[model samples]
Target chain A: MKIVTCIKQTFDTEAKIVVGGDGQISDEGVNMILNPYDEYAVEEAIKTKEKDGGEVVVVTVGGDKAQEALRYSLAMGADRAVLINDPALEKADSHAVSVALAKLLSDKEAGYDVIFAGKEAVDDGAAQVPSRLAAKLDLALANVVVAVELADGKATVTREIDGGTEELEMALPALISAQKGLNEVRYPSLPGIMKAKRKPLDVVSLADLGLSAEDVASKVEMVSAELPPARKAGQKLTGEVDEVVAKLVELLKNEAKVI
Target chain B: MSIVVCAEQRDGKLSKVTFEALSEGKRLAAASGETLKALVIGSGVAACADELKKYGADEIAVADNEALAAYTTETYAAVLAAYIAQESPALVLMGHSTVGRELAARAAGIADCGLVSDCVAIESADGDYLFKHPVYAGKAIGTFKISGATRLATLRPNVFAIEESDGAGAVVDFAPEIPAAKVTVKAVNKVSGDRPELTEADIICSGGRGLGGPEGFKLIEDLADSLGAAVGSSRAAVDAGWREHAAQVGQTGKVVSPNLYIASGISGAIQHLAGMGTSKYIVGINKDGEANIFNVADYGIEGDLNKIIPALVEKLKEA
Candidate 1:
């Protein structure tokens, strides 16, 4: 059973986003880190490998800068890292990226038992690539999984819904997207970080995967970037709690009519 | 050219978002002089065709079967992919929901198509469509164009308006050849509560770290029940373990745009605002008058929420 995990390099969640004069976002002076959600996938992959006596490999689709993200996963106990860095793939939409990933991993011929990824990339919030990749690879897919139980080539997964949970059972060679609370992500030990520097990290391109530019071209083209409309300030209602509630209810009934 | 609107259902009832998708599909189709068709899939859902017809659907395609009663990723995606491959519609649209997010991606893969998810707005010009969606956590917006022959996108709930019109009300049956499902749904653990889903709620009442502890949620729950609103929480409350992460509203959590949003004891962090800023009306209540939440709130009240919430709950009950 070989475990492959997908990771992404994204701007820190708390970083202040700046728009450039080119009408695009400015990543300058912003910290880049592995997507937080993917951290859970990395942890789960390592734990599964430890329990099942297999190897964990981390894969990513981004530019040269994404190598550091893969390194972070390698330090977390993965045995190998693969980076898909092609200028043509920059800022590619989910559809294009997933296709490239499916092609790259399947070409490995490893017969992977499980592929893991963050449910949604925090930067784009697309949340589509894993499922699309599953379709491309013709594997069973489950997203936002909080719990997973593996036994005898079968995987039982529990996904979180709005008000409850949905449990599903699937065969091996499946894809499971990680959500928060799946497991506690462990920091790399000093020795593990040193060992990661020598681990095998391979960089592949469109040519390497035997794919043409048009075959993996992004159908979704980004047009422009803009900020949302700013909210306006409103009057403050000053009074006791009781008076405030009374005034709010009055406003709701007569002014807004939402009640 | 035709636009296929995938109608979603649960427990033999159509989702409200299905109508919203149909309405938008109709408008887009009219702009391009194309046909607008509704595809309703489920068991015993033939009656949904009449409702879709009222929503301006030129034709309705029904795929009713026992195997389609519950949503399975493989079964649903296979069925939809086969339909798309056969009909070759110019565009496919569905709600950006749990099922839609998973199904759209899988279906796109099966057909080797393209998709843009969580679209806030859609526009058509000269047979080409543009989708507006938030990137970088609502700090910036990205407008996308799909040049492929077949395009797919999922619309955010509550963003598109629902419009009704009279149509031919024609019904067509579509039999999808479903392959053996690789996955099986064991059970769905439903939380027994009358509250609406947070993402789909028209009104929301949220709490934050100011609530102090888990017991403080009683105030929010009571007010929410009184107003018939869903309960939400800032990431602070969820991180503090005072509330479940499912109730969290922030950049990493669910993005919701409701008609009215009441924030009790929650300071307006940019991440939290990114989720709920699109709400039509916002009311902020906190002990500090200088909280950033007041900046975007339509109305601000300076006080402790523990006191204000109980008072508001009582008032709402009386109303």
Candidate 2:
């Protein structure tokens, strides 16, 4: 069995982010890391390989800085890595990115038995890529998969639904997008980190994939970003506990009318 | 110009968001100088057509198909696309719920247009419609202009005010040339949550990691029970495994616009604010006065939630 995982790099959430004078987002010396959701995808991919005895490949479309994200996946125990990097791949929207990936995956080597990705990226929160990719690849796709049992040449998938979950069986060569709490993430040991550097990583530029920068970008561009207006802090309520409670009840019943 | 509003109904009854979308569509139509139209689909569900008219729809397009009895991507999209292409409405509007977000892109895909999902406020500006979307979760705001002539947008429910009437307008039966059997629902599994439906709740009580554990939600539930409010959670609570993601309120979770939002033990992260920041009124209960939740809170209570919430719940019961 062969599995492929899609990953991306995002601002390290722990870092303090700031908006500069030019209205651009600057992390103010904060570090960058692989998206946490994608980490779950990587972990699930590795576990699937361990269960079915297959090779796991981590694919990332990012910049020179993204190499570190690829390295992180390798450190966590992927068998191979592929970087679709180029100056042109920047700011690719969900649709174009899925197209570029589907073209590359289809026209490239190694027929994959399964593909996995996170439900959505933290930055954009556009949960369209996985479904779009599956549509483009013409693969039997399951979006937002929470659990899976790959056996008997078919994968029984458990998907989250309104107030509950559903179970379905799909044949091999399927696509699945993972969500958090699906599996426990493993930390890379010292030896695993060392072995990561020697792991096989194939770096391919966007040009090599026969796609130009425009093919992967949104026809729409984000010219500027700004913050929402903050509401005035509510009048501070102070007194003994009962008094404050009385004030709150008055507000809810009279002023706010929430109750 | 004509506005196409997707009327979302459940079990042959109209969802509140349906009226919200209808209200928004009416507003958009009046703004754009157009007539408001509606599209209804389902199995044995012709009764909802008359109710939709009272909400402001002038012309209602009915597609009675057994396939649409339940929402399946293929069935809904195919029928919706057919209606959209035929009518060529100036804009299409749907409730900015989870199902709305999921279908927005697919609808845009079929229409070959761009979509601005999760829009809080929308209006026409400079001969183009401007969509106000929150960026950086709820920490920021940005305006988007869709160059597409047939604009698509999903508005957050409960944010828009709903107007009711006794007027029932013209109902036209236009059979969508599509078979429902083609799109198999395959299977549906749902969890039965004890909490009131978060999206439909008029008053919401959400807890954060400050609550300490899953047990803290019990106090939240107690308060909510007293107030007849839905229980929700911050991402910290959801990520900490104290609550389900469905109950999460933030940029990554469901965006809510309840009349009243109460945050207990939540420090108010930007991501969490993005989800419920648009509520009509927000009350923050936290020990830290400097907590960001206070920035948008209409009432700030600086205290320990464990001690304060119980007292508040008791007060509500007494009231």
Candidate 3:
């Protein structure tokens, strides 16, 4: 059994996001970490390998800084890491990113029995890359998986839907995106961190993957950006709970007209 | 030319977001000089066609199949892909609900087209469409322009107004040969709640970690019941095991734009605000005046939720 996990780096959830003067995102003085959800994917991939005696590979697409995310995955227990980085690929949309990933994974050297990824990157929240990559690879895919059991060339997956849960069975050579509450992620030990520094971290380009500039062209273009408008302050009702409740009732009936 | 809208239904009932999608589809099709068509795929959903027709759809296409009774990425994608491949509509529309989140990209991927998800607004300029959506957890808005043979977009629920109408239109039977789903849905445990869905509710009352424990939601639920509103919770409440994930309203949770949103004991994170900030009216109740929830709240009541909620529930019950 061979497993490959897709990962990304994003701003820490607590980081204050600010738009620069040029309408581009400014992450100055902010901490960057592997996307929180991807941690679940990496943990699941490592755990599966620990149980089934297989190799785990972590893959990422971004600039040089993204290699940190790859190393973090390696530190967590992945055997090797692959970085698909180029200046031109920085602003690529989800579609282009999927194309590049599919191209890279299709390599005979990158043969994988199963693939895992976070349900969505916390930054873009697109939730499209892994599914689209599965489509491109022509593999079965299940997103937002909470539990997975792989055996006999098949995977029984449990996922959350609108109201409840659904148990799905898919053959191997499948793709799954990890949702939260999947598992508790473990921190990298000092020995693991030291070993990760010596792990095989291969950086590849689009040309290396047999992809052209035209093949990975972004379909969605960012036209503009701005901070969301500030919400106006609402009137505060003081006094006892009864008074506040009385006032709220009157306001809902007369002003808001909701009740 | 036509603009295709995927109408979502569950258990033989149409989702409100489905109507919202059709409304936007009508506007976009009119702007682009394209006909609006609604496509529903499920078991026994032929009756849903009339609702789409009344909401301004020019044509309603139903792919009634037992295999599609519940959503699986493969079956829905294949059926929708088959329809879009044959029709080649200028634009494809769906609601950015759980089903849409799973179905939209797969269909677009199979159709070999581009998609923008969770769009709050769509603008047409010279027949080209530009979509506005939130990124970076709703702290900033990004406008996207997609260029492809066919365009796909999922509209955020409650962002678009549903058009009023009383006219039923034509229905066309679309029998596509759906392939066997690679993934099988064994069972579905539907939520047992009489309150409206969080995404489609007119009024929402959400609680947060300030309630201290799971019991805090009791007050929240009581107020919600009295006002005929849906119950919501911040991610903190959900993560703390105070509420179900389905009731979570935040960046990772369901985005809601209800007519009235009441936040109790919630210290708003940007992620939570991103989900509900678009709401028409926001009321915040927290002991701390500095909670970020107050920043976006239209009405701020400084008090303890434990007392305020019960008192409010009593007042409503009396009224």
Winner by lDDT: 1
Per-residue lDDT tens digits for candidate 2, residues B1-319, read 6888887665687777778888888877767777888887777778999788787788998888776777655456667778888888777888765456555555565555556666778786554677776555555565666655677777766777887743346899868776333223457765545655687678899999889899989999998988888889998888888898778887657668789999999998867876887788999988888999888899888887787788887888888
Residue-level lDDT of model 1, residues B1-319, one tens digit each, is 7899998887767777788898899889888988888888888888888778898888899988888887887888888898898888999999888788888989998888878888999999888889998988788888888877899999888888889987776999989787787889999997728999888889999999889999988999998888889999999998888987788888978889988999999999999999999888899998888899999998899998878888888888887
Candidate 3 C-alpha lDDT tens digits along B117-145: 88999987887899988887777888888
Go through the candidates in order and give each one's DockQ: 0.78, 0.37, 0.68
Off by over 4 Å in 3: A27-29, B166-168
lDDT of 1: 0.88
Find the candidate with the highest DockQ and give its number: 1
Candidate 1 lDDT by residue in tens digits, A43-77: 99999999998899999999888888899899999
Question: Chain B alone, model 1: TM-score?
Answer: 0.97
lDDT per residue as tens, model 2, A100-121: 7786788774499889888767
C-alpha lDDT of residue B195 in model 2: 54
When candidate 2 is compared with the true two-chain complex, its DockQ is 0.37
The lDDT of each candidate is: 0.88, 0.76, 0.86
Better of 1 and 2 by DockQ: 1
Model 1 Cα RMSD, 1 decimal: 1.4
Worst 10 residues of 2 chain B by lDDT: B178-187
Docking class of 2: acceptable
Arrange candidates by DockQ, descending.
1, 3, 2
- Name the weakest run of 10 consecutive residues (lDDT summed) in model 3 chain B: B161-170
lDDT of 2: 0.76
